[model samples]
Target: MITKKPTNKRLGEILRQANLVSSSQLEEALSEQSQTHNRIGDILVRRGWVKRETADFFATHWANLVNETEKPLKQPLGHYLKEAGLLDDEQINTIISEQDQGKLWVRLGASAALKGWLKQSTVDFFVEHLFPEQASDSPFTKAKSSQKTAKGRRSWFFSQMK
Candidate 1:
């Protein structure tokens, strides 16, 4: 089982960090949320600023990714990405099939990026933030250090999307 440290990050913050939604967009969603009492994810999806799956993914897993405690991830990176609504069944199957047939040594995140299903930055975000141990030797770690410096200035919220 995987366990995470406590965090105060919110869905909007995570989405913003991922470069999925802009600050103005998040502010608009929040303004609407104030009046409707609807979920921020729902508002963002309705506005088309973010995909339903992306919103759902962050809503579900942002906490686990930000936790400071080191816990073993029980599954591969693809598993969490799928649950985060980043990857679908067909995408996973295609990646696996290609790996088996071609004997490709590519990681799932790289495969997904190469196929254009996800941006490289998104995969990098998951690797650097969610699974730091796997990323220690990866070139992606270079960016992680820079991100940590910026992270201190960001505000966080404890509200859940739902």
Candidate 2:
């Protein structure tokens, strides 16, 4: 049996964190998987809790992304999120357009978070793991450190304007 990395979240956990499925639904699916001897992704897809592509992306491509250390990622964070079913083409286009209109340089992940399309933890996970080299340079990290209180939280780019 293939084992997942300790740092990597399971497919169900990822789906839950992304708010794609409810906890009760996941538990029910897990129960069915125990009796059906089927892949969790397949079970979820069959139940219509998740789209086929979304399940496939997590089952097939997620491991590759997590374990990819030899090759540097050429695509931006939005690409991965979209592939993972967390984002759609429209959202990606919107983010890109917004970035283009902004004067300051903001990471795509930061912009997504600002728009409430992604959670801070989710962005942090990708930046810290997938783009370790760029993590320190990320405005999210800088802002998180500087703003200890939630009310004071602001991206470095926005903070610079004041």
Q: Give the alpha carbon lDDT tens digit for every residue of 1-162 in model 2.
A: 222243477888777765667799999999998998888899999999888888888778866876875656665566677777667777766655554555434566787778798776777766666666666675633334232332222332234334
Show model 1 residue runs off by greater than 4 Å.
1-6, 34-37, 68-70, 136-162
TM-score of 1: 0.70
Give the TM-scores of the predictions, in the order they appear: 0.70, 0.65
Instruction: List, residue by residue over 1-162, the lDDT tens digit for candidate 1.
Output: 334446677788788777678899988888998999999999999998877988887887677656746655555566677777778767876765665566553667888888898887888878877776556445322333333221221111101111
* Per-structure clash totals for the candidates: 0, 0
**Which segments of candidate 2 are over 4 A away from where they belong?**
1-10, 13-23, 103-105, 140-162
- Over the full model, what C-alpha lDDT does candidate 2 score relative to the true structure? 0.67
Candidate 1 overall Cα lDDT vs. reference?
Answer: 0.68
